[model samples]
Target: MTTMKVTERVQGMGGPGRGGPFGSSMVGQKSMTFGPSAKRLFARLAPERVKVLAVLALAVASVALMSIAPKLLGTATDLIFEGLFGKQLPAGVSKEEAVERLRAAGDDRVADMLSSMNVLPGQGVDFGAVGTVLTVVLVLYVGSAVLGLTQGLLLNGVVQRTMLRMRAEVEDKIHRLPLSYFDKQPRGELLSRVTNDIDNVSQVLQQTMSQLLTSLLTVVGVLAMMFWISPALALIAIVTIPLTIAVTGAIMKRSQKQFIAQWRATGKLNAHVEEAFTGHALTKVFGRRREVERQFADQNEELFKAGFGAQFASGLIMPTMMFLGNLTYVVIAVVGGLRVASGTMSLGDVQAFIQYSRQFTQPLTQVASMVNLLQSGVASAERVFELLDASEEPADAPGSAASVSRGRVEFSHVSFRYEPEKPLIEDLSLVAEPGQTVAIVGPTGAGKTTLVNLIMRFYDLDSGHITLDGVDVSSMPRRSLRGQVGMVLQDTWLFHGTIRDNIAYGRPTASEEEILAAARATFVDRFVHSLPDGYDTVIDEEGSNVSAGEKQLITIARAFLSNPALLILDEATSSVDTRTELLVQQAMAALRSDRTSFVIAHRLSTIRDADLILVMEDGRIVEQGSHHGLLAAGGAYAALYQAQFAGPVVEEESLV
Candidate 1:
């Protein structure tokens, strides 16, 4: 399978517009491989068979009831025709005689009475026999309809339950996968699996059971009656079977590839639309309106073409089978008519064969109409399970610790890279003594964020050793590694809730006192108090409720409340206003006094006072010393200091 060079996920579903304007190409990616597990899943659907069976039974009964009434009328017509023409029968007495005799002798009172009433000439009974026949027919009709309604209720319940379980299973699979899995997927495509794919499966499930059951039962029952009445005509009817099947099968086979194309095109299209919406602000600022629209139009055109092809192909089978159905009916009539005249079959027998001919074709046509749609649903099901099969991070063994001691960190000969031999960090080594502030400063994309990400175990290093209190972070569980490391990141993400909720999110179990303490220290409490609701105020999704500066402080409070021994502040104030920056600095001072902290900052002035300053370049530490000592050496550290620190410093002596 070929792979796309994906950067970020757009959407997580498989639907139209996956590659709308910003998504990566969905081509050359892996296709879902169906296997034994897929068959097992079908077996899991075994219990749902009962619902299908009920629906089929109801449908068969309805069709059979309609078939029976037609023949019963035909039978009464024969008895009257014979009695009036040449036998021992009274003139103008045939209708009453047909009704009274059949009701008493044949247990077909309803059929006879209906035949006595006029229904339609050259069809069935007339209206005169309506009362007696209708009473019983109404009961049968209503009963069958009631069963059909019940089947609908049962079918819906089964489909809904199956989709619910499948959705939960898909969710668990998504979170279980390693972080790299998301890099290869678009959020909209993945989202489609949960929302659109599952929804499509729901529609198929709603109809399949009833359709399968009714068609099979009615077809079998009708063919059986036809065979009993006259094997000759029934045998002739079977010849049209092969032709009907070939037509339907060809339609299905052709539609399969088109559907697969439709599915892929949809994923690509969604990827683009998701990207457009997600980076809408960037697009607006850059004035990329025409460019974005052109991109969208390109992806959408591909989706529309593929979708139209699949739907158009699948839709034709219905009419083709219908045309063939009429042809089959004509052949049955011509062949059956000769047999009746030649005394080879009785009039009633000929009548029965005609009814069965129509009944039998009903199923073949129904199955023809729905088979392509059925396969599409199964194709989607296959995709859902394929995702469930993706590789995931190993679950941590039970008994893994979730606690931390006094913050102490050490990285020994640490090295990492996204690609082999293209090192981002080369033999990087550093130490943050317990309760000391160590700052790492470097150019953009110089492995600064990568270092913090490694500490959190977001990605494993190629060759490196990071430890906390002499314990190897790698050998320990990821949960254990992350539990001991707290960070205030440069990019602050807020959820839809109160400012209080955002801070408390770090440690949901933290007490109100701890939360307030963390907030007060970070100066978040000050702004929150300025607002009408204080800590009770609600916020928008992603912290749209506050300024970027305030968002940073709220994040600081989150880190503080977690109270991890090791704190990494990566550009905490780089994007904030000067006013909030000072408040955050004071909060940092309070947080770092008793913790071992690694501060990675671009603003040289912010970290110059750190106990140790490490100048990094090309993944190597070019200089390391105290701020004044490095400045005295007139090296890289001195140059970086000259670039950023024009502000008045609180002298070391005054701070001490």
Candidate 2:
């Protein structure tokens, strides 16, 4: 496998293009409802259902424990208050007698306040009882903390595992998708779905899952406790809930659209940046830096507008919730105070009821605030789901295996098109006998590369059949067919690795001696010997440390190492200088011995010695013969040759 071939396999297909199958229209559309997306997201957690249930149970236990502590603290407050007030009463006097004595002295208000407290006439500050109540409250709080911590840890494990599986599925899906799918999609936008969107989903889950559950349970537990203390006060405290829901609902409706827009803008911005950076040198050469910058600014502005709108709208929830909560607090406080003065409720009960009211509003506030995160998460989830739901290529035929012996290939009335409306290659047929060299020459978009791509099965035919060794290529398992073919394209791709490692990439188990022999055969040994690290010289990510010709040589060396039965050279020597091109040609000549080869070349001189030379135009074979035979015939090949070497020739429409 050459480096370009490996890149093709990994990236699937398609380079930077206009619009993808998942186009801008899809991205720009508002996420009207997240119900289905949320359902699908939760379904991914089905494997972790037991852990999720445990988290819920822990949340319930923790909230229950914490809720009881406030009430117990209220009891402690009552004990201290009752004891302090009891000291003012006469010693050894019954509570009823003391109250009557106080009433007889025109102290009815004081007597009424005393009746509300569970006080002994002779006692002062019951320290032991207060200490016991304080100890139980402390234990409840500690237990709640421990449970919360345990649940947090468990939830993290569940999330990490879920994300791991999600990433793996995305990777597998990419490999299975057809090359045409990539043709419509931008690299940066696809990457955003894979990396940024999925990461956002994970973050949203981490931040909201446990907290939402705990808040909801706290609300339920606290509400029950409030009602248990005083039904009227409980009712008053819950009055704000409808208003809270209405406010949150209205804000979230607007913010959800903005969140969707924000992520879409993020994808577009990332796409622009990736495209700009990848072709930065070209942009500079063309002096289009200012244009690129202007485009970037436009996309950046779009992202900012969307992001600001989302955050600003969601930010309204908290302050609005706080205001409603304060209103409820004041109402409850006033009501509880009047009830206490009337001797209908004790001081302890009223204090506990007030604490429950705060607890109730707090969780409500939390649930309302988390709406932003939920919307963001669901928006990202929809993007990821779109990727996962993309159409995949047809599955390989069952029990399909190609057995190649002499490398005979035949294109029997083959027809193919990139788009249904545009016929690229139609009714194409050819045969390359075992060990024959066939050269394909054509203008751009004349189906030269497309011809070889069909043989490799990078694409499937629209009609007819391509057979290798008398077996239909479509019926063969793609891997089984691809394993026998070696490819070298004009555009060389070298990954970040040592020269030796790159040469041995196609066959990782190749011996060092085989690696050296392949490198030497490709004229790579001459260059390697001059470098400090020789065969171990590391290539940077961009392969910038090496010259363009050197990168091309390394890819040729990789093809040589693979020692394939069928060879493809797609303008493989286009990058080298004249002197180096001679060396590469000699190397390719040696490599082509006894192997069937397809060489697509723009340079006519390189294919003059080929057994068969085909001249293609408009996806059809205009001429085919030896160089001398075509030159003598004075046809399209002769015209192209004349234009290259002899002089300017009158160009016909077919030639153009």
Candidate 3:
């Protein structure tokens, strides 16, 4: 039951799914269980791939460029400090007063104000030194900004393209999938994968991956510059690298699992809401509003907790890394300052050490926070690949023609189960001549619908074979075989279009006169004519304006207009009132001429006129004859007939 429902929802997912710098490795082998079939699903987005690589390169360069500014500022401080605080510098006035005069001679703010890079009131600078510092900044800092912009644009492009490609492939898979796949999932659950899951990937791309690359570059570049300034200080700063990574990695790995659970729960929640809304009438009639609301509330709350848990946990990384990084920086700065005061290092070198210390921690902090983003992108990628890698039906046989007119159909020792353990049909064999009507009558779940499903090639049988004009359906093109079969279900589905469009659906080439002829024969023309625009009257999805019987009649009109060589009618008049049933029956009868027809009926009177009647039990045909022959057999069919049509002559008459 679970599998069948999922496959049904899967069919409705004939659309896209979502992901983005989506570093997700493959989900645990579910996609790969389909083998080489999965390869076709992740159609390569080469442009996105190129841009991702390009942006990563740009990010590295931008980080390197940014590291230059701190060093240049350090250089300006050293030059001015040497001039102002030489061997016999003014002692009583204080270092602050000495630095103030150096700035007036062009040492600038690097050796003044609240740490380096200061603005002092009444301070003046040599124009030449000011121009020199500004020049270096313009060359280095401006270069970093330009590179950052380029990387940002490219990363955005790559992420968007990857998502588009993923969605396209998932959608394509949906259309190509066998009908049975649809029975396995929910419509809304599948929808969430495309929209919500893909968006998660995009979010990572827009926010996380870029941060990760930039931070990684910063870490690398800052370390290099710190080494240039003071190898001793740089080594001290590197002490926390492994511990930081271990902490960040552990937090992200755990959150990845939570994020998956969160997304799955969110999909379930969406599925529940969709189910409630779609079956709103049932919920109201059963007075189940509170029940549905409670169910929704539970699922909604679960999503909230799971989502908040995943994000809240991931959010902890930045602050934790920041604190650890700052602690490391303070340790390095104090040790380096003591060395400078002992004359073991120059003031210029000490200034440079402090600048490099800032470079070390800040970049890694950015990198640490991006782990969460990377994890989300990866999780979404796994979901997308899951859909794409699902099993698809076999390709049409080679050398099979697209068009074939052999309209005869034969069933040979056929048996089937939606799943292996539960058999629905077994060892049933029958044949229908051209222009003959073969009616199959059985209780619900007796394989009446499964038999029709096999004929249309909607599913492959587990045992034996079905043939169209002696050609095995499995060996022929599925499309060619189905092209010859026109089916009408009890439930009529109408798209948002005109009445004429609905009738002409089967054959868009059909003329207005032909559509009218079909509608009139089905008695839909009567009601359609009553509408303001008659045949041109607009309809909505599922045809809300019409009665169930009227909708079914219109669908029958469409089938008639298509003029299929083989027609399958399942419960043709099952839902209609007696009057509408009568009208639809006339149309059904008209549609059966000169064609191979299969009728599955519960109303025995409708099948009495069929060329042959097969009574099925437990997936096999137990009785085969005319209506009277089966009635006389005194078997399961007879028992069922009497239970439904026994007692008195009037009771039997009521069946008519």
Candidate 4:
């Protein structure tokens, strides 16, 4: 029931790989590199400097408390050991007397071991001292836990607020981008950048920011504690640092490339899926289901390969780091045991040093594992930043002209092209006097729609100017120039809302009476009153509940409600039935009274009464006159009129 213009089909055939409007293939697009992207991502947090500083300070304090707790536990261990073994000594002997006696008895090793224990020869364990040390350790852990929780809460707030601002800026950028930009980019690709990529960026910030800071601080604190306990053991532990760095650095460098490829494949896949869904009915009717599915499978496989590479590379970090850490742990234990036996270090200090060694390596492992999230996040951030950095539409002229008083429109030597070398409309000149109905007729790709687009300033002229009521459209604010124009395209768009709300979209502040008047004038009232809910009937998301003709009528009502000075109808009757077309043509006739109207139609029957008829070919007007006059002159218009109405069917090429 819907007509597909030849021009539209031809345009669709040229997409992506076909060297159409999209220009280049997306196969080898490269994202920004990791170093610069990470820098930019962190720069976005500059506005929350206070919160970030607070989070860092809390991380430092928490790690400091947790780092000291293990040493205190070692103290408790010493107390219990001295208490348990002190029972072997002779009763009522002073500690110095027993040590001298042992030395006199030729037990020098035992005497020295007793000296290292630092216990009275006859004393049992001090339960009170052990209890006190354990109590202090418990308090330190609880304080560290509290500080960590507060830091997480503050960090979460900072990330959410930054994401909120980023989403708003992206939306504003979308509005400021030129229509030509959209012509080259798929809706799905842009949508993935706005939604999926931003969400990934948010997740990365929330998960990695605080944990990365804590792990780094823990490394510094634990290393300091390890050196304080015993420098030799600390040096043994530090030997593995260079090896861990080398392993992590190598894995991260390769994983980052795969991560970028993964996200790019994701965007391309999303674009394909969105296109398929939007055109599901057409795809099924044309029996292109298998082709669509094959394309999807191919893209899906690409995503899987890229994702596997990224994950496998990043996954190597944890196990390799753990293996290195275990080797360091074993070395530290053997050396510290020898030192304990030689009486160069106390049993308590050696125990504390072993715990510090584990703490030191654990943070390094943690940081290595977090590199995966960091790389993925930076990859997504680069995509979002690319959108933010895209070339925006030129700014409107400063102190521009405001409103148009009359609907007079003139295009003086206007020239433009979507591609620089392939001019679509060149040196086109025309005048639409106020209150005149100009009906333009031509075959597909004759630049009918392009001419209307120029008048509306959807694009700027490469050379020449468009004037509205003697005021150059470039000088006027886009909002002001577009405010006085109403357009009804062949495709009817309706959001999920009530019938009345859709009609009122054209003039948000219109009263109930004004809306009713527009509906009646556009024949929308005829259908609305028949429905059970009248004006309040809700349209579904796709607006599929209503027939196509009803949808077109509603759109006409919307434009009618606006009461714009200049009106444009582009194949507006192409979707409706013959009876419905009659109603639409009648409504359009009423709407055109006292208003300058530009109607582009392929149906010659519908425009015979137009005040002016223009026949265009190859971006130029080949003939122009009133409908009767053009036919009587027997030129291109006459041939087109004969082809449609009177003669034997003429070939489309011959008419052109």
RMSD of candidate 4 to the truth, in angstroms, is 4.3
lDDT per residue as tens, model 4, 1-656: 11111222113212333222211235345578788899999999999999999999999999999999999988988888777767778779877788889889998766776677777777888999999999999999999999999999999999999999999999999998877767767667788899999999999999998988999999899999988888888888888899989999999999999999999989888888877887788777888788888888988899999999999999999999999999998998889887776667777888898898889899899899999999999999998898888888788898755666578888787777766656666666788898888999987877688778878888888888888888888888888878989999888989999999999999999999999999998888988988889999999999987899899889999999999989998888888888878887888988888888999999887787788888875545878889889989999888888877766444655687
Q: What local lDDT score does residue 533 receive in model 1, on the 0 to 100 scale?
A: 87
Q: Pick the winner on lDDT between candidates 2 and 4.
A: 2
Clashing pairs in 4: 83-125
lDDT per residue as tens, model 1, 331-382: 8888877665554655556676777787788788898777767767766776
- The digit string of per-residue lDDT tens for model 2 on 535-560 reads 99999999998899999999999999
Give the 10-residue window scoring lowest on summed lDDT in candidate 2: 1-10
Model 1 residue 371 distance off true place after TM-score fit, in angstroms: 3.0
Tell me the lDDT of candidate 4. 0.85
Ranking of models by TM-score: 2, 4, 3, 1
- For each candidate in the order shown, give its overall lDDT on alpha carbons: 0.71, 0.85, 0.72, 0.85
TM-score of each: 0.81, 0.93, 0.82, 0.93
Model 2 alpha-carbon drift over 4 Å, by segment: 1-16, 19-32, 103-109, 647-656
| Cα shift from native, residue 505, model 3 (Å) | 3.5
Better of 1 and 2 by TM-score: 2
Q: Pick the lDDT winner.
A: 2
